[model samples]
Target: MPERALRNNSTPAELAVWHRISRFRPAFTRQLVEAPFIIDLACRQAKLAVEFDGSQHLDSVERDARRTAYLQSKGWTVIRLWNSDVLANPDGATLHVLEKAAECLGGTHPQPLPSREGRER
Candidate 1:
């Protein structure tokens, strides 16, 4: 199995929530670092990962710490968000996740070519 498949073991709420946030047209894929065991979401191009932590995560300090360390070792910047936080403020969390991904991408992600919308300034 791939690395991502081993990572994302999020709750139903988190999974459903991230599914929406992932709608953003990022520079690359949204999920692929490691799967079921993964934190939450990720942008492969940026080498950044996002985790939506609910009650379970807090209950296991050692597991969380080890996971973070593993990601860092793989050169991935990890962003964590509490379940309640995301439920209360999804927009903020999504933006934060994007920013972290951008940070990993060196902050200069190449924008896709403009559509044929006509522009002759």
Candidate 2:
């Protein structure tokens, strides 16, 4: 799909976060897998899926519960961030997300700093 179109369809909140994250590397977003389920945002290698929770969930608690159960059954770890969280603590939230993903992938929490000046290798 075209870049302009993607931005146009995304929520302003989602777009803002995406813009910041895209500065380094793009994080995956809405995707459909073999079945009909469309994930909010996921990383297959990281085995992580991120979602935004809103008032709608309160109205459909059972449905959300089932969906969470299904994903967990499939071995996918799901993380939920609230709309207010994205608005209030975008930076901290981003770092927390990166930390969780790294943890799941069995890597260091804070990606190690770049190799220093050569000491004559």
Candidate 3:
């Protein structure tokens, strides 16, 4: 399916996760296209792709593995989250994404500002 259509028809789990991650820095793209496949969500700067999978995905483990391998070959780190888990605990799911992103980016996102404890104000 086209990227736009997949984004427009996002599953509940995807929407929940996006709601939390979309507000952060280094921004994430939903329904991102990487040629042959459409990523559920991706932080391009970090080269990280997050995939939210539903029950149907259980039937296609090999297909998903191939997709992940292809993306990995292209230097993308893929993280998969179950739909049930996201719906049950969106905060935890988003935190995992943030942590992975930070790991991939090699530092904290939005880096902390310099302190000015003694500056005139």
Candidate 4:
């Protein structure tokens, strides 16, 4: 599906988590296209990909595993959270994403992209 459509049709669990973490400094993109695949959510600066897996994923364990391995080989850290877990504890799900971002970025706060106003103009 197109990224925009994916965002518009996002599951309740995804919307919940997005609202919680979308304001992070380095920012995140939902349904981010990464060539052959479209990651559920990705923070490029942190090289982190977050996926909210629903029941359909249960039947695709091997496929998912290979995808994760491929992403890892490409230097991306993939984190998957169960849809029910996200719906049950959105805060925790957001925290896990933040924690993984921090870890991947090697810091608690990623250095923000400077705006024109913050640079010599």
Candidate 5:
């Protein structure tokens, strides 16, 4: 399917994951195109690609492995989550994504400096 169509027709698990991770720093894009593949969700700055797999994936283990290898060659960290897991525990799934993103992004994100306008003269 076309990327745009896939974005518009996201699965429930994809929607749930997106809702949780959309606010993350470095940002994430849904149905992001990466040459031959369209990532379910991707944080480009972190070089992280998140995929939500359903029963259909069980039959394509080899294909998924090849895809992972290809993405890895391009310096991307690919993480796959089961659809059932995302639906059953969105928080846990979100945390997993955050952890992987942090790993790919090299630990915690840099904190911004506090504003000085509130300080007394």
Candidate 6:
């Protein structure tokens, strides 16, 4: 499928986020084609889709809304994250995706342990 080609062309942010969540018990597939749409990353078993959007999306709010509505209508919970956010704070982005996935799967999301990297001394 054409969408499968996207896996190898993902942005750095997408790769970072995918690397973290791909280790989940259920697993997520990148560039999953769901007919009318191609999800960035999806855990079909949990009915969750995670999209990493760049600045272009900010100018396409309506388009994004329509896409999101369409996906939600099909029983998929969509989580859209800015690429900058994913790149700048991979742990935070991963946490958000995991939480959303847990919600759609009817389970509690696990929080990452506190870290000192960006914490106040």
TM-score each candidate. 0.70, 0.74, 0.90, 0.86, 0.89, 0.85
Q: Clashing residue pairs in candidate 3, if any?
A: none
Q: List the candidate 5 regions with Cα displacement exceeding 4 Å.
A: 110-121
Q: Each model's C-alpha lDDT?
A: 0.65, 0.64, 0.91, 0.88, 0.88, 0.85
Candidate 6 lDDT, tens digit per residue, 10-91? 9999999888887775678899887888999898888898988999898999999999999999999998889988899999
What's model 1's TM-score? 0.70
lDDT of 6 at 87: 91
Off by over 4 Å in 4: 110-121
Model 1 accuracy (lDDT, Cα): 0.65
RMSD of 2: 3.8
For candidate 1, the clash count comes to 15
- Model 2: runs farther than 4 Å from truth? 1-8, 23-27, 30-34, 117-121
lDDT per residue as tens, model 1, 21-42: 5565464343453533454566
| Model 5 error, position 114 (Å) | 7.4
**Per-residue lDDT of 118 in model 5:** 78
Write model 2 residue lDDT over 11-111, tens digit each, in one string.
54465555555433224545435143555566676667776676667797788777777887888788887767787887876776677777877775435
Expressed as tens digits, the lDDT of each residue in 20-119 for candidate 3 is: 8898878898988898888999999999999999999999999999999999999999999999999999999998898899989998753346788899
What is the Cα-based lDDT of residue 88 in candidate 1?
83
Regions of candidate 1 where Cα sits further than 4 Å from its true position: 1-19, 27-37, 109-117
Candidate 3, run of 10 with poorest lDDT: 107-116
